[model samples]
Target chain A: EPEVTQTPSHQVTQMGQEVILRCVPISNHLYFYWYRQILGQKVEFLVSFYNNEISEKSEIFDDQFSVERPDGSNFTLKIRSTKLEDSAMYFCASSEQTDTQYFGPGTRLTVL
Target chain B: AQSVAQPEDQVNVAEGNPLTVKCTYSVSGNPYLFWYVQYPNRGLQFLLKYITGDNLVKGSYGFEAEFNKSQTSFHLKKPSALVSDSALYFCAVSTHASGGSYIPTFGRGTSLIVHP
Candidate 1:
């Protein structure tokens, strides 16, 4: 089965530095999403993208976060300035229609 | 807002015994419920979902979920337990939100440990 794929399984960056997490969602899926889980916490939604625009975002997705489908397959989440609290496992997910979503292995971001 | 509740922090079961991971949800409209399992160092894998179904939904790895609208719950069950099934399980509820999308809210995960 085809699955979502993410790059840089682990990322370590200095505080206040810019970082981008990349994901290649299932090729045929039309909707994409970003979520994060701080260690020992529930997975939180960050943002969703469809039709080349943001569909919705959570309060946690503040001024610092931005997502873009730079290419047909690549969906990228960029954090303008990282904070310690931003350290978490970031996951990318996609769905063929709107019901079931397939997730990627996730990228563990550690902001020092 | 749609929300999911996984009351138990962890569940322990013996090998060959049946296992159940509980999940409850709150949603304004009809809910789209899902269960996902995460093995250590891996991503969340879709176990099953409850859309407009016959209440009993079967999924991958011999797993199944029963959606109870009256109780507003969707719980995952398996007839037999395996050590390999030990992992972090999450329950989520999705509802229509702004931007013409259905956003999911996840509950704090429940850890399942199967003892041999």
Candidate 2:
């Protein structure tokens, strides 16, 4: 079965630096989403992207966060001026329609 | 908006015994419920889903969930538990919004520990 794949399984960055987490969703999937989970917290939705535009975002998804589907296959989430609290496991998910999302392995972002 | 609640933080079951993880939801309209499992340091894996029709939905790995409309619950159950099934399980509910997108809301998660 086709699955979502993310790059650089682990990322370490300085608090003031920028970080980009990349993911390649299933080949034919349309809707894409980004979610994060703190070490021992619930998985929180960051943003959802469809038709190359942000469909919806959570309050946690502030100005520092942005998502882009630069190409047909690559979808990326970028965080600028990361804070200490940004340390978490970021997951990428995709679905053909609006239901049943398939998730990627996730990238552990460590903002020191 | 849709919300999911997993009442138990952890559940312990002896191997070969049946196990059930409780999950309830509150939604304005119809709910699309899903069950996912996560192993240590791994991403969430889809176990099963309940959209409409059929009160009982069977899923992956000898697991099944019964959808109780009156109770507003979709609980995950396994007939026979195994040590390999020990992991963190999450229940999510998706509700369609005006924009025609079904955004999912996840519960805190339930930890299942199967003793051999």
Candidate 3:
């Protein structure tokens, strides 16, 4: 089965540096999403992308966060200025036409 | 806003025994419920979902979930527990009210431990 793939399984960056998490969703999937889970916390939605634009975003997806589909298969989430609280496991997910989403292994972001 | 509730923080079961992970949901319109499992250091794996038809939905790794609209529940079940099944489980719900969006509102995960 085809699965969503993410690069840089683990990312470590300085507190004030910029970080970009990359994901390659399923080739045929139309809807892509970003979610994060703080250690020992529930997974929280960050943003959803479709048709090369953001469909919806949560409060956590503030000014520092931006998502771009730079290519057909690559979906990138960029954080302008990383904060300590931004350290979490970021996940990328995609779906064909249903609510059933397939998630990537996730990228663990650690801010120093 | 649609929401999901996983009442239990943890559930312990013995190997070879049946196990259940309960999930309840609140949605304004038709509910699209799902169950996902996560192993340590990994992402959430899709377990199963309930869209519109039958209430019982079977998914990967011998997992199944039953959707009860009257009670607003979508509980996941496995007939037999395995040590490999020990992991964190999450329940999620989406509604048509959100423009058929696939974004799911997830509940706090429940950790399941199967003791041998």
Candidate 4:
């Protein structure tokens, strides 16, 4: 079975520094999404991307966060300036026709 | 708005016993419910989903869920539990919006522990 793949399984960055998390969704998937799970917290939706534009975003996805499908295969989430609270396990998911989403192993971001 | 609730924070069961992780959801329209499992340091793995089908939906790893429309619940169940099944389980719900499918809302995960 094809699975979503993410690069840099663990990321450590200083506060106020920019960080980009990369993911390669399933080959034929259309819709992509980003979610974050804080330690001991529920998974929170960050943003959804379709057709190279943001389809939906949560209040937690503020001005500092941006997503890009720079290429046919790569989807990236860029945080302009990281905060300590931003440290979490970031997951990338993709689906065909918005039915069932397949998730990647996730990138653990540690902001210090 | 769509929301999912996993009432229990943790459920402990002995190996070879049946186990259940309860989940309830609220949605405006028809619901698309799903169950996912997460191992330590791993991503969410698709367990099963209920989308306008028979109430009982079978999924991967000998697991199944029964969707109760009247009760608005989709609870994950496994007949015989294994130690490998110990993981964090999450329930999610989504519904159709104006244009297309709505973003899924996940419940706070329930940790399942199977003691040998």
Candidate 5:
């Protein structure tokens, strides 16, 4: 079973620094998404990417957030300026056509 | 907007017993429901989904969920609980009217604890 893979399982960054979280979705998936979960909170949708463009985004995905395909295999999320509240577990997910999404192990970001 | 409600914060069950995690949903059109499980420090794992057709949907890890259209509910059930089954479970919903571009709305999640 092919699974979505993410790099830098855990990251620690300064409050004002920029951070990039990378993900490689399933080889044949056409739709990709990013979600985040604050500690003890529900997983929140950040953005969705298709055809190398953002399809939809949530309020949490404000000016500081951007997503890029960059390459055929790599999808990344970048935060221009991190805040303490930005610390959370970020997940990348993919799907073929159905709504059933397969998720990666996630990247834990810690800001101090 | 599509939304999901997981009323219970946590559910405790004994090993070898049946366990259920409740989920209710609200959507404008026909709803597509899903259940996912997350272990500590890991991402969400797809458990099962109900798109159309049969109300009973079977999924990985010996889990199943029944979709009740009348109640707008999809609840996950496992016949026998294992210690490994202890994890955080989430319920999600999306509507077909969104033209497949809609992002799923998730619930607050329910923690399941299986005691031996």
Candidate 6:
């Protein structure tokens, strides 16, 4: 079965540096989402995208975070001025409709 | 806001025995319940979903779940446990927010360990 794919399975960056996590959602998916899980914590929603615009975002998705469909298949999450608390496993998910979402393996971001 | 609660932090079962991972949900409207599994170093995989069904939903890897609306719970079950089934399990509920947007609220996750 087709699945969501993410690049740079692990990312390490210095504090205050900019980082971009990339994802390629399933080809035919209509809704895309970004979520993060701190070690030993529940997965938290970051943002959702549809029709090339943000549908909703959580309070954690503050001014530093931005998402864009840079291309037909590429979904990117950019964090400006990363903080230590930003270190977590970031997941990308997509759905054919808006009901069942398939998640990617996730990118582990380590900010120091 | 929609929310999912996995009451147990961990469940231990012996191999060849039955296993159950509990989940409960709170939603404003009808619930779309789902179970996902995560192996170490791997992404979360869809196990099954309960969406306006007959209350019993079977999914991959011989796993199944029952949806109870009255109790507001959807718990995952496996008739026989395998060591390979040991992993982190998460329950989620789908709901619509303003502007007709659908979002999933995930539980904190429960770790299942099957020992031989």
Candidate 1 lDDT over residue span B1-99, tens digit each: 778999999999999999999999999988999999999989999999887959999999999999998899899999999999999999999987778
Per model, how many backbone clashes are there? 0, 0, 0, 0, 0, 0
Candidate 6 regions with alpha-carbon error over 4 angstroms? none
Q: Which scores better on TM-score, 1 or 3?
A: 1
Residue-level lDDT of model 3, residues B1-116, one tens digit each, is: 88899999999999999999999999888888889999997889988888889889999999999998889999999999999999999999987534456678999999999999
DockQ of 1: 0.83
Stretches of candidate 3 above 4 Å error? Answer: B97-100
DockQ of candidate 3 is 0.68
Q: How much is the lDDT of residue B69 in candidate 4? A: 93
Summarize candidate 4's per-residue lDDT along B1-116 as a digit string, tens digits: 77889999999999999999999999998899999999998899999988886999999999999999999999999999999999999999987654354578999999999999
What does candidate 5's lDDT look like per residue over B1-116, in tens digits? 88899999999999999999999999988888999999987889999988889999999999999999999899999999999999999999986433356579999999999999
Q: What does TM-score give for chain A of every model? A: 0.99, 0.99, 0.98, 0.98, 0.98, 0.99
lDDT per residue for candidate 4 within A25-80, as digits (tens), equals: 99999999999999999898898888889888889999999999999999999999
lDDT of 2 by residue, B76-116 (tens): 99999999999999999988755556778999999999999
iRMS of every model, one decimal? Answer: 0.9, 1.1, 1.7, 1.5, 1.9, 1.3
Superposed Cα deviation of residue A5, candidate 2 (Å)? 0.8
**Candidate 1: TM-score?**
0.98
lDDT of each: 0.94, 0.94, 0.91, 0.93, 0.92, 0.93
The TM-score that candidate 3 achieves is: 0.96
Q: Which of candidates 2 and 3 is the stronger one according to lDDT?
A: 2
- Candidate 6 lDDT tens digits, B27-47: 998888899999998888999
Pairs that collide, model 5: none
Cα distance off (Å), candidate 3, residue A67: 0.6
Q: Which ten residues in a row have the lowest lDDT in candidate 2 chain B?
A: B94-103
lDDT tens string, model 1, A1-110? 89899988999999999999999999999999999999999999999999999999999999999999998989999999999999999999998887788899999999
Residue B107 local lDDT, model 6: 99
Model 1 / residue B72 / CA error / Å: 1.3
The residue pairs in collision within model 6 are: none
Model 6 TM-score, all chains together = 0.97
Once fitted onto the true fold, the runs of candidate 4 whose alpha carbons sit more than 4 angstroms away are none
